[model samples]
Target: MNPQERPSWRQQSPEVQQQVRQDSEHFRKCLDYLREHSAGEHEGFYGPDSMTWVIYREPVILLGGLRAILLQIAHPAVAIGVAQNSNFRGDLLGRARRTYTAMYQLVFGGLPEAMGAAKRVHSLHSRVNGALPAGAGPQGEGRYRANDPLLQRWVLATLIDGAMEVFETFVRPLSTEEKRRFYEESRLAAAQFGLLPEQMPPTLEAFYAWYHEQLAGDALRVGDTARELAGLLFNSPFTRGQLDELLTAGLLPQRWREAYGLAWGLGQQRAWRLLKGTMRRAINLTPPTLRCVTAWHQAQMRLAQARGARPTVMARVLNTLDSYVDVPFSIRPVAAKTPAADRD
Candidate 1:
């Protein structure tokens, strides 16, 4: 069968068939790559009950992602690795796509696919180690490793924390218990990636205490490479203008804003609040399935329930296409690596 061919649509009316055909062509490559990578026999790190899953798949992934990158590059090693090893600046969209794909695979891909993704990350990180660039603060940390558990912990922490920030800011606020569960699940995910328990602080309190303390000092100060990336990220053109980046900047701690040489004034603060409020209202307006990353699966499940039968493999694949949105390529601008990465 042709990779893009949708034989399952044969019995459907012309309208449905046309829509499915467009979807199949639109998402063919991504779907094919996913199919080629099997989940194998290993069970995934997170089940449906996992809080990590609930928070990770939101529409604000890019918003939280920007914060995660800001946090990652604050680490000199991660900064240096991204500056010297990755082509983030030269091709920010490509970088963003690669990073998000790895994340999606971990969360949604099959077990074998997830493990293979992890190993590939390890291999990539193994090649990204060396001295931190000068002027990155006195506590230079000597060297940076992509696979360093300590670094990995911080990177994962940013993703965990940043996701909550975006979720609460734009999506609905999580309950206190939900927040705690999310952090615990985040730690669980990190542990599977070889991050030790001690590497990740248990609670949100520990995260602020441990990591925030680092941010306040030399350890998390922005290096030249980091600053450059941060500048590019914020200054880049987006369809939404710089409103998205400005909103993100407004959410940053004053100390971090200063570190990046970004000065947020009252005007920016007001604008952020106004825009955020509008966004909050609009989220409710957006379709429920469109808001979450699992929309395809959710839609598929609904269809199966309605049909009173299981969906076939082709059906599942095609449904994934229906949920596809070019997240990284848009947000109206360019967008990761300031904090740690999936592997490290």
Candidate 2:
């Protein structure tokens, strides 16, 4: 049978449909709880908007869990290669390399904000540190130092990996034109950050500046879409003015309006699901105040076993791993720590 003709949840067997309904109901309850409880102040860099709330609530936990699985199942060489080719070696290569490394660790290690809402972030942070080459890891133990090369790489890696996950897991296969458009947009955004194809910056400051700029552009695009949607809703033949007013008043947040760009582009539903999944994994792997990348990794292994992967998904994911490892970066086995020699 053609893959497109395969039965979806709605067309499943009666028992399977019942299970899906139960799961959907559970998910709705979870979402409602998230909407209610995530209102107060946040302890991170982002604020108390719906997007931020969704991010901190369940999605982070889910994404963290996914990251844990990816780390465990994926070969170490794949991680290292992704870290290397992510940026170009150039003037200030040391700083550029460090910034990318930090990005990777932040995403892979899962560092938490200072506000103390999520402690698992730090657990993954420490695990990645332990995994890093000696003299290369998070600086000062808690905060991501601007000067730390390893930390820089971790940060970059996280962004790239997170974005890629959304692309692969959620976005349906795109046409060649769609793929070109997406890359074109990404490239244009990257260029605005002073990231030339051959001259990528090698420091945290440059990376952050560029990264934020890209996000800003994305926000603008999203904002435009939101406005168009609002106009459409308002001008709809069946939409009463009173109802529109109620929706505008109750549902729209100003921040979301301003930062409305969809990271998943036209695939809003899938993007939203992917984002929620990412957050959920992130949170589950490291609950507030706890530090344990190993636990997260173990959890992923269990989940994979439980899911009973089809040979095709397994093969594709493995191919991704192989492609990842082919990037030019060093990978070494985890080593046993030894005591330092005493000074004579």
Candidate 3:
């Protein structure tokens, strides 16, 4: 079918139209509530930084969620083939690939840009490690150096775990079968990173702790301070209160305060300020509302056909046309607080 010639909601049955109307209304309500709450004191919660977080974070969550959904759909032996053939698997794998690529860019590409100022601090840590007495600790204490490659693997593992947790929290819920699928997929990814399934941490908290240890070592190597690491990863300034809140919210691990300090050394206050402005614009813009009246008309036609009504093609076309009315798009000035700063 020509893209523009595809049937509209009016071409669907009445039942479908009603369902679309209900869905539209539900979405509108949710959007309205978000806008109202976003304008309050908790503006930061809905700012551009937050939107970027969601955009970057959503695919990981969806990949996990869909894995769960597929498992549920495949529970019955007879449904396995149907589930496999559905486009869902392809869509989800694409999302996973995109997320992985983004993560790689964040760590390897953005890291330098985000941590330029922390190089000196990392050098200081390297000097301290080198100057430590030969008998600094017990016989085996220095065997596993902080900068070991193995430790870096562990840190990546924790990042994966954190990503998964965020997915579970904000995204759609899944069935038991879906959860099983998620585990299986996670295990495969972990294997690629040189980690055995048996070595995975049992709880999210434990994984985070392990992850932060790796970050600490990386800070030492990169000559960054704790604040710098925190700023790079969380995209926020390193304040004591912010650190406390991140820990409480399970956003960052506790022992890496020094790494976070180093990370803050590379902070760009202007980037965050611009992000805030973009968020304000996004929240104020109303989402386009869709009316699936054509679907309703189609349903009616289908019903009439089932009853041997024998309606002519012209009548069907007219019915579909009558069900919809388009209003011109209008721009309205939205009244909201001006952003704290303006950027070019």
Candidate 4:
């Protein structure tokens, strides 16, 4: 019998289990990719104690991810990459899945697994280059590649900056020292995508200045493709996306927000504030086990234990949700993973 259809699986909340099974295959495919492609040379990119793990595990990632996606495509090179290289518009959510899974593996998988995931991405990126739309300057001979260090920097920058924005808004503000270390550590993480140290902005201050300058100048554009992507995200078939629409707009630099046609009404501002306030308090009460990254990592360790592979990561999720991520089957999908802001 299939694992998901086993007798024990029949005992969970049928409604909940049904939803879990709906995406279990997708979850396993991502995990299986890591396990299958992992090499001995790749242990893992970051450690368990890293702040990136702490920050990323939170539900706030839902907000950060949506913000990052919107910010990335604004750059003409990234725009062209998405427009010509993939079916992002046709399968918007799938893009989110691929990006999120890749990042998750890079940050949390064993070194070999992370390397395997990175190698796959680099191979994909190497082939993805094209002409920029007429007005949006794509830098470097008017063509762009996924492997371009400059473009990689921008994409990584958006993730760090946007994730930190949501982190501060819905969680505690990091100390100056903490924030600096976070950025520096993040620069190292960005290297997993093939960035050189020199390509990265030397400091957080420099990064922000460059980021702001990009927004200030013509480094970003809302071409027909980006507009369609923005529409797909904000106007998703899921009504739950309304909050993401609001939060994503609220987080954007004002000019681009307006360009994306995302309005920031007084009502939206008040609601956004209320939402953040509520989440801050609620998240405080959340036990660590409920965090998606933590749960999945523990599950991976458990699977390793069963297979007699000494995993470097540690601990098990509280048993309640742990079984939902059964070994040799699939991990449960994180709730509201779509566009990373369905529930945000």
Candidate 5:
């Protein structure tokens, strides 16, 4: 469909329209918040010293990306948006890379870069809206706007939940306090990602409660679109490895695992345990130069330069992987074609 021919927020049902306005206002204030808070601090919202950066720097966290994607699409609204508005089915890896890059920018980029990343995501989401078709479960045929904070909350929640699950399972377990700190950092990013403070759970304990509730709740029904896409995703060339099955099957909530008809039994559990142990030991023995993702290396270089010190030889070598790490998303952003007067 032509961009102009797409429905506007004005044409949405009253409930969705109210949500869109609330999300717009909340995101506007979020931008203002970033502008005020992101002064001379070269380190982004969560710096190198933060638990967020520490956990996220581990390459093992990448395992959570698939888990997060599956969880996001399990929401009927998210499924409808992706099935209708995105080319994810044809280019899932590209979609995953974009998501990873945006996350890296948010976690590692300086204030301006982080804000820019947030705006870019908001811009992309601005165009993703439609109604869930019939048979999409209880909420089927309801309006869905990507900017809706409630839906955004679920997406972010899945990331938070998946990251913790993968990190603790593959890397090492986190202390109660460590988990709390990580979640606190996530709450800050949540604000930048369109959530008002009141919309987010106030504490890690509360977040856990909420996350579990959502997982078992009827709201996250895996419908036809999500199920078909997930089947393709796990079976696709990029993700057909045994490790992918282990990750997806092991990390997905039991209800969702059943909803998607993924097989898991005692044998699979043993394999998951074996794989988890093997990865943890191997990663612990690996040096930071080989352990962290390229984005961490790049961030380290940026920080060193900011402090008038050249990055160490090790960092320089690791940074070389930047071009190869997420090659599909290496291109620069295109300027928006829509004129301001014509913009939605």
Candidate 6:
């Protein structure tokens, strides 16, 4: 079945507009649920003890950034939305920095901050809607809204899968229980994006079945728009891109590698294996403070201060650096909001 062939988001249609209102209402409820259940003084959706923090705090997750984006755009609707709405070609690093910052805020910031970040992203996504171009495969006539639940689900899946791949490859493998816990936490995060529980797989094993089917199926087509976006990411007038291309190509699903026309032979495979081994060794030797990202350190500092404990010297230093990068330190309480159509 062609996923993209599903009915498009039509703004003028009363049905679609009603669906949008329903989605907004659902998202607000999800936010309330999170605030009631997961929001502590300093803990966001997933606290410091969560498997999310364990896997995501590692700096190696950065290696998965491109992999996630590549997998996201493999869906034709996503590629079209990105191609139409993004300024990635003109401001790649700035775009990437903002994206990473928002992700960090969602994962590591205080409850209010995480909610604010989620609202901001949802608002921006509310504006991204367009039809696929001609010769865009079988779903050329389909329209897309970034807020579409299925599209959001696919994007979320890519992020989770990419992070899991990088963490397992360059750090250590997780047990089934560990992975299951992580997947459960991810569902909570997914709720922030307006996805209903019924829309997602109920368990980790079920998710893998769905994810593997996506990887192996023709549902993912790397079209012209996707290729253009990939070129912008992989061949910009940025840093030397050899290592970036190597890692992205090596880490992408084998089917997607072929779809994207990335060459992967014995030499590349051997090199990838050697690099993975070296990274695993290096990460094993590194101390946690050095191996973790600044956002993790900032979260630790925030929590420490809330408990009236002095943060470590390294935590203070990293907190200062994180500030320079515009990482959010706090969020004010949520105010009474207007309607989504008006506010967004």
Extract clashing residue pairs from model 1: 39-110, 39-111, 39-112, 72-338, 72-339, 73-338, 73-339, 152-344, 238-332, 239-332
Q: Which candidate gets the maximum TM-score versus the true structure?
A: 6
Clashes of 2: 58
Give the C-alpha lDDT of model 6: 0.78
**lDDT of candidate 4 over 32-61, digit per residue (tens):** 444443333322444555677677667666
TM-scores for all predictions: 0.72, 0.21, 0.28, 0.74, 0.86, 0.87
What would the per-residue lDDT of candidate 1 be over residues 88-173, giving only the tens digit for each residue? 66677677768776776566544555556755665455445445545552344555556566677778777776788888888888
Q: Could you tell me how far off, in angstroms, the CA of residue 299 lies in candidate 2 after the best superposition?
A: 26
The per-prediction CA RMSD against the true structure, in angstroms, equals: 15.6, 25.2, 24.7, 13.8, 7.7, 7.9
- Clash totals, every prediction: 10, 58, 34, 8, 0, 0
By TM-score, how accurate is candidate 5? 0.86
Task: List the candidate 2 regions with Cα displacement exceeding 4 Å.
Answer: 1-44, 50-64, 67-114, 117-148, 167-344
Regions of candidate 1 where Cα sits further than 4 Å from its true position: 1-43, 134-141, 237-240, 294-344
| Tens digit per residue, CA lDDT, model 3, 174-271 | 45454444444444233323344555655445555765554464222212222232233333232244433333223333333232232322233344
Better candidate number, 2 or 5, judged by TM-score: 5
Give the TM-score (vs. native) of candidate 4: 0.74
For model 6 the local lDDT of residue 134 reads 64
Output the number of the lDDT-best candidate: 6
In order, the Cα lDDT scores of the candidates are 0.60, 0.31, 0.33, 0.64, 0.75, 0.78
Residue range 1-344, candidate 6, lDDT tens digits: 12333345553477556756776887887777677767485888888989999998888888888888989999888888787787776788878778887888888888878888989888777666656666553345466788888789999999888888898989899998999999988877787777766778999999999999988888788888899888888887763466787788889888888878776888888888888889899999999887787778777777776765666677777666554555433222122223335444
Question: How close to the true structure is residue 202 of candidate 2, measured as C-alpha lDDT?
Answer: 46
100-142 per-residue lDDT for model 5 (tens digits): 8888888877776787888899877866777666656344556
Question: Best to worst by TM-score, what's the order?
Answer: 6, 5, 4, 1, 3, 2
